[model samples]
Target: MPRRTGWRVCSVPGCPEFSDRGGKCDDHRREAEQRRGTARQRGYGREHETRFRPAVLARDPICVCPGCPQCSDPDSACARPSEHADHWPLSKRDLIERGLDHNDPKRGRGLCGLCHASSTAREQPGTFGLH
Candidate 1:
């Protein structure tokens, strides 16, 4: 069943805290980050930092979430400046599995910090206590 549109208890199995952001509460969120390790450890390497990320950001200077909420109209592209070069449609892991260059700028879109965090929390495995 789909979760209702409101705050809920923390996603960590026995935790009693509440959260309105990612499913995990603050403590679990911190713990999960510690477990997840650094960006380099997760495969974001020098090529990503020096090439892919900059290229994507230069190509898309604004947030590109469909119907981005940062704009006055939720049906419009966001006016907020982009802060992240995000992998899209195909996740980095998916691209690698398919033998495509995971750091290709064409595989990414620019997103504001808010949009990036929201999408990461929602879509990334092991986030929100799913793993």
Candidate 2:
């Protein structure tokens, strides 16, 4: 087994705790998650879990991001399995305000967890740069 080593300062802006996790320390991690709210609070309720998510995943069993290309091109796309059903070209809030079905599978795309997190951090305001 590989050894677990290395530590960095906690990412809570002057918290002054060295963490092997690369983000917040254990004490602060829980606090951060609580502040972020639960999945239902974030609008991923039953419909999203049961209908929209399953359909999108079925349609795209693999990551569809440009970085995860399916062709022979090496620098095109990823080969990671899809793990998230993401809203494309619009967020759930944007769809709702426009009187659209926010959970419609037609408006979703499949992405790997890494791709989804990266995309979310880049596209969603106030997600990054606050810390």
Candidate 3:
């Protein structure tokens, strides 16, 4: 039997580092963290708030982060003071591929800011290219 190398290139585009965890390298991890930080700072826009508030409230204000079941109560399990009404249904690339016209109210979905930013980043041409 031959020894099999488990190392692989990072999943993040343009990165050169190698890793076995999700194919992401240290640089990608740092880039992702920076992007998340930027997204958190921007917060959700007025359109998202006005349009998705009712839907999010109706479903019980929550963080919506995978593996996290916390509500949106700042004083409770949900430490985050604000919860973003993320586009749950459509992905960023899906929106881009479908064009802006497809991002109609009828196609929107809810998600937390963190998850939303992460999803949106996937559609960008390069890492942290959402600007």
Candidate 4:
């Protein structure tokens, strides 16, 4: 008969104990948890922003640029249909002063990439009125 082996040790570098699922020791597992928590706090851990997606869905999927209508085309070689979520009516200084959150529904709206670029350029001194 074959002899049974004991619990497998953690595979994470520098870890010395076993984990049933993650291959991490308890200390490393806790560290990994801490890292995940920090990432969530910083807004990089989740796939969807809380408000942006629903708001965009509620509105037409088309770009909101005046005189220009386009759909989202994530992979299009052409620029018109590419979607960009942009902050409206708010200057960079305003956003910095208010510390606007990117996910805030009241602070953002959808636009085409070209329109977004144009709006950004309009905010620059030399580019104003050019678009």
What candidate 3 gets wrong by more than 4 Å, as runs, is 1-6, 11-16, 35-38, 45-54, 57-85, 88-108, 111-131
Q: At residue 85, give the lDDT of candidate 2.
A: 96
- Clash pairs of candidate 3? 11-23, 86-111, 88-109
lDDT of 3 by residue, 1-131 (tens): 45456888898778788986655787788877776675436444555456555565445355544433334443433334335554446644465577653324455544566645655665454655343
Q: What overall lDDT, based on C-alpha atoms, would model 4 receive against the true structure?
A: 0.57
Candidate 2 C-alpha lDDT tens digits along 1-131: 45577998888887998889688888899887887787887778999999999999999898888853333564777667999999987987789889999889999999999788877877785663222
Point out the higher-scoring one by TM-score: 2 or 4: 2
TM-score of each: 0.72, 0.83, 0.34, 0.39
Q: Model 2, which residues run further than 4 Å from truth?
A: 1-5, 68-75, 128-131
Q: Which is the winner by lDDT between candidate 1 and candidate 4? A: 1
Candidate 1 per-residue lDDT over residues 1-131, each given as its tens digit: 45566678998899999888858898889898887777887888999999999999999998898776445688877768999999997877789889999888999999999888777876884453222
TM-score, cand. 4: 0.39
2 versus 3: better TM-score goes to: 2
Candidate that scores best on TM-score: 2
lDDT, each prediction: 0.83, 0.82, 0.54, 0.57
Clashing pairs in model 2, backbone N/Cα/C closer than 3 A: 67-77, 67-78, 68-77, 68-78, 69-77
